[model samples]
Target: IHSDRGSHYRWPGWLDRINGSGLIRSMSRKGCSSDNAACEGFFGRVKNEMYYGRNWAGTSLEDFMCFLDRYIRWYNEKRIKISLGAMSPVKYREHLGVTT
Candidate 1:
């Protein structure tokens, strides 16, 4: 997990969660927002596009997890980006003859 040095991110509960989950915490250097700009932008898009204003009152954790996973796959493989000539990253790479 990558984050800026915000107070909440440094909180005991947050730290415990990350440590308990065995996920390595990566923090950006001091005063360098651009270091994680692309990641931040992707997270912002995810939150806005899928999470904002949505009610998950009766959704089970497993179902929500599945939804999130599918959404990310779709975002990376199907959703087109205007900056990539209106192609998804996968398609743009293929167009450039970059095999993956």
Candidate 2:
């Protein structure tokens, strides 16, 4: 998992969980904004498209997870990007004859 060198990530509980899950921790160098820009941009788009201005109060955690999963699927498979000539990521990949 990629993250900044934050104190929270260094906490014993967090380290234990990462070790238990067998996830490799990849921390960016200090003051390296470029290392996180892509993920930050993606997260910004996700918040703007599905999270902002939504009344998520009273929603169950399971329901929230389901909604997020569905939205991500749609974003990858249905939402078109002008930069990709108005094709979704999945369609663009297919057009390029790329297989996942």
Candidate 3:
């Protein structure tokens, strides 16, 4: 997972786990936000399209939890995108004949 040097990601033991899994660790430089532009772009799109004008902002945690669950399902299964060749990511995998 890509992230800032925030509390959730700066754990000392995390290096061992990442190395054990044989996954290369990638990170931005200190105070260099452009090094992580992809993450920022996605976050910005989600916020603008799904969060900026929502009245649900004032909802209770339980309501927000329900909304999140439903939203994720819709995003993964029903959402289509031009970038994914006009298909949902799941559908794109299907086109490649990939099996879960």
Candidate 4:
């Protein structure tokens, strides 16, 4: 998993968990945001498209969670990404013969 060099990520407990899971840890280089640009871009798009101009003052936690879940599904299954041949992530995976 790629993450910033946060203190929580560097804790012994977190390190143990990651090691036990066999997941490689990738940290961005010091003072460099380019290494995590893709992740940043995704957050920016999500906020701009789904979060901006929204009022969540009275929304329950469950309702917000549901909205986030639906948006994520739509992003993966319906939204086309220009970098992926104008195909949604689900379609791109299918095109690559990846069965999920």
Question: Highest TM-score, which number?
Answer: 2
| lDDT score for residue 70 of model 3 | 76
Better of 2 and 3 by TM-score: 2
For model 3, residues 40-84, the per-residue Cα lDDT tens digits are 886686677677888885799998878777776777787999998
Error of 3 at 83 (Å): 2.4
C-alpha TM-score for every candidate = 0.77, 0.90, 0.60, 0.65
Clashing pairs in 4: none
Off by over 4 Å in 1: 8-23
Task: Find the candidate with the highest lDDT and give its number.
Answer: 1
lDDT of each: 0.92, 0.91, 0.78, 0.90
Clashes of each: 0, 0, 0, 0
lDDT of 1 by residue, 1-100 (tens): 8879888788999999999999998888998999999989999999999988899899999999999999999998889899999999899999999957
Considering only N, C-alpha and C atoms within 3 Å, which residue pairs clash in candidate 1?
none
Candidates' RMSD to native: 2.3, 1.3, 5.4, 3.9
Candidate 4's residue-wise lDDT over 1-100, tens digit each?
8888888778899899999999999888999999889889888988999889899899999999999889988987889889999998888999999957
Among all windows of 10 consecutive residues in model 4, the one with the lowest summed lDDT is: 1-10
RMSD of 3: 5.4
